[model samples]
Target: MSDAAAYACDNVSTPVEAVQAVLARDDLTPAQKQEIAQGFSARGLEFDVSEQVCVDQG
Candidate 1:
C-alpha cells in the first residue's frame, strides 16, 4: 500500500473519518483533496458537510 493509504487505514475506521482526516491535513494540495473526495463518492460513502464542520470545530 502507498504511505497515504497506510496512514488512512491506521487512523480512520470509516470513509467519512478518512475524509475528515484528509481535510485536516496541511500537507495535501487541492487536487489531492479532490481525489480523496472523489474516491469516497465512488465507494458510495456519504457524509454530511455540517457534521464535518462540527468535527472540525470540536
Candidate 2:
C-alpha cells in the first residue's frame, strides 16, 4: 500500500469509519456501494442511516 493508505489503515479506529470512507467516495456506483455495505453487514458493522441519527451529527 501507498504511504497514505498505510497511514489511514493504521489510524482508522473502527470498521464503520472505513466503510463510511468508502461510501463517501464519488467513484463507486450504487451497486458497488451495496456490495461493500453487505460485506460490512455480514460482519455486523454499519452506519445509522436514519436522518435523526446522522443528519444532525454532521
Q: Name the top lDDT candidate.
A: 2
lDDT of 2 by residue, 3-56 (tens): 998886777567667788887777877678777777777433454321123356
| Model 1: how far residue 33 lies from native, Å | 0.3
| TM-scores, each model vs. reference | 0.44, 0.50
Error at 17, model 2, angstroms: 0.6
- lDDT per residue, candidate 1, 1-58, as tens digits? 9999889776556756667887667787766766666666644355332223235555
Provide backbone clash counts, one per model: 0, 0
Error of 2 at 40 (Å): 1.2
Give the best candidate by TM-score. 2
Q: All models: lDDT? A: 0.62, 0.66
RMSD of each: 9.7, 9.1
Candidate 2: 10-residue stretch with minimal lDDT: 44-53
Q: Give the TM-score of candidate 2.
A: 0.50
Off by over 4 Å in 1: 1-13, 43-58
